[model samples]
Each structure stands twice: as structure tokens, then as C-alpha cells.
Target: MSEPDVSKVLRLFKEEVKVINVGLEYFYKELRKQGVNAAHVIWQPKPELEKDLEDILKKIL
Candidate 1:
């Protein structure tokens, strides 16, 4: 496939691009402080027997 236009991608960055922070709440907060549209997904280790979280991660990945 052909490469995407870098200029177009850079133009999008000039606008508000919503960010989904999978971890590190502080990083999300810092983005907001800079007037960025950001959201956080609180992540933590679940019990070893838990499979639901792993399934969700698979879908996202």
C-alpha cells in the first residue's frame, strides 16, 4: 500500500485529537493541561484467574 500523506496527518494534530490513555492517569492529566482532548482508561492487574480483562485487551489490540 502507498504511504499516507504526512502533511495531512500533521494538519490533524493542529486540531483537537481525542486521546485514549490506556494507563498512567497523570499523563492524561498533563495532556489536558495543555488544552488537549484526553481521556483515561484506568488499568490495573487483575487476579491471575481472570480472563475477562484479557479478552477486552485482545479486542482493543
Candidate 2:
């Protein structure tokens, strides 16, 4: 295997990066106010029993 292309990754980051704010509405609003492309998702804590499964699903989905 070989090292990845850092220049290509940097170019893509500069051109097409986006921010996803999963919990805080204020942070998302602030980012948008700064002219950034951002999105917000309302997130809530699951019940204690469901927390473990929800964490796994969060990673997979």
C-alpha cells in the first residue's frame, strides 16, 4: 500500500466540505451565519436500555 494523496484531499476539503451539527441548534445557526454550508439534526438521548443499540446504529446508519 502507498500513502494517500494529501493535495487531492486538501483540494476536496476546500471545495466541498460541509458541517453537520447533530445536537445544538445554536452552533448550526452560527455556522450558517458565517456563510458556511451546514445542517442541523435534532438529537435526543435514548433510554438507558436502548442506548447501546442506538450507539451502534448511529455508527452504521
TM-score of each: 0.52, 0.54
Top candidate, metric lDDT: 2
Give candidate 1's root-mean-square deviation (CA, Å): 7.0
Residues 1-61 of candidate 2: C-alpha lDDT, one tens digit per residue: 8977699878877795688899989999999999889889999996575778888989999
Residue 57, candidate 1: alpha-carbon lDDT: 78
Q: Relative to the unseen true structure, what is the Cα RMSD of model 2? A: 6.7
Lowest lDDT 10-mer window, candidate 1?
Answer: 45-54
Question: What C-alpha lDDT do the candidate models reach, one value each?
Answer: 0.85, 0.86
TM-score of 2: 0.54
Expressed as tens digits, the lDDT of each residue in 4-57 for candidate 1 is 779978988797688899888899999989988877999998658458888887
The CA lDDT at 33 in model 1 is 95
